[model samples]
Target: MMKFRHLRYFVAVAEELNFTHAAERLNMAQPPLSQQTKQMEDDLGTILIERGSRPMRLTRAGGAMLEHATRIW
Candidate 1:
């Protein structure tokens, strides 16, 4: 089962594409934001964001999940 908190974290980061900015928007620290994203990926058994890349992009699964998540919220 996935947590709503994880989903919120993911959506914020996915939209911002920057942990620092996402963290600011989420009103949380960057480390925990990263951790929640990792937890979400671990729960789904797949990679989501491509960290440390210029113009970050989401994996295919991540894109799909974001779509569903958007509809969910």
Candidate 2:
């Protein structure tokens, strides 16, 4: 089951595309934010963001998930 915390983390990271900024927005550390995102991907069984890429882009699945998440929230 997916958690709301995971969704929140994903949304922050998705919007910022920078772990540091996202973490700051969440008032947490970058590592935890990254870990939460990893856990979310593991639960969903797919890659979300393309880490280490310039101007990070979401995977197709990530894009779809983001859209749904937005509506659900």
Candidate 3:
């Protein structure tokens, strides 16, 4: 079950492009933030952030999600 917080967490991570920074911005710990973001991916059945990359990069889907998430936020 996807929730609004999933989008909010993802948006923070996407905007910062860094999990640590995004977690800090969101006033939460990194592990939980990472977990929620991963859960969001699972719920959507699509990769949003390229976790394997250094500094991270948003996938095409991620960019589109960010656009919508930002508007909603």
Candidate 4:
């Protein structure tokens, strides 16, 4: 079962595309937020985020998850 918190975190990261800002927006530390995102990616067995890009790039799956999660709440 997936946690709604995880989805919320995911969407935040997706929208902000930067962990630092996203973490600030979520009122949490950046490391945990990034860890949560990484955990989500691990759980889904797919790479959600593409590194080495400014503002971070969302993979196709990442975009899809963002859209879906956004609709969840």
Instruction: Provide the overall lDDT of each model, using Cα atoms, as 2-decimal numbers.
Output: 0.89, 0.89, 0.95, 0.89
Ranking of all predicted structures according to TM-score, beginning with the best and ending with the worst: 3, 1, 2, 4
Error of 3 at 39 (Å): 0.4
TM-score of each: 0.94, 0.94, 0.96, 0.93
lDDT of 4 by residue, 1-73 (tens): 5688989999888889899999999999999998998988988999889967885999999989988888886
Residue 43 shift from truth in candidate 1, angstroms: 0.7
- The per-prediction tally of clashing pairs is 0, 0, 0, 0
Model 4: lDDT to the true structure:
0.89
In terms of lDDT, which candidate is strongest?
3
Off by over 4 Å in 4: none
* Better structure of 1 and 3 per lDDT: 3
> Which run of 10 residues does model 3 get worst, by summed lDDT?
7-16
Instruction: Give the Å error, residue 33, model 4.
Output: 0.5
| lDDT tens per residue, model 2, 1-73 | 7899888889888888888899999999999899889999999999999997988889999988888887777
Candidate 3 lDDT, 41-69, residue by residue in tens: 99899999999999799999999999999
* Residue 60 of model 2, lDDT score: 93
Least accurate 10 contiguous residues by lDDT in model 2: 64-73
**How many residue pairs in model 4 have overlapping backbones?**
0
lDDT (0-100) at residue 49 of candidate 2? 97
Scored against the true structure, residue 28 in model 1 reaches a CA lDDT of: 90
**Candidate 1 lDDT score at position 48:** 91
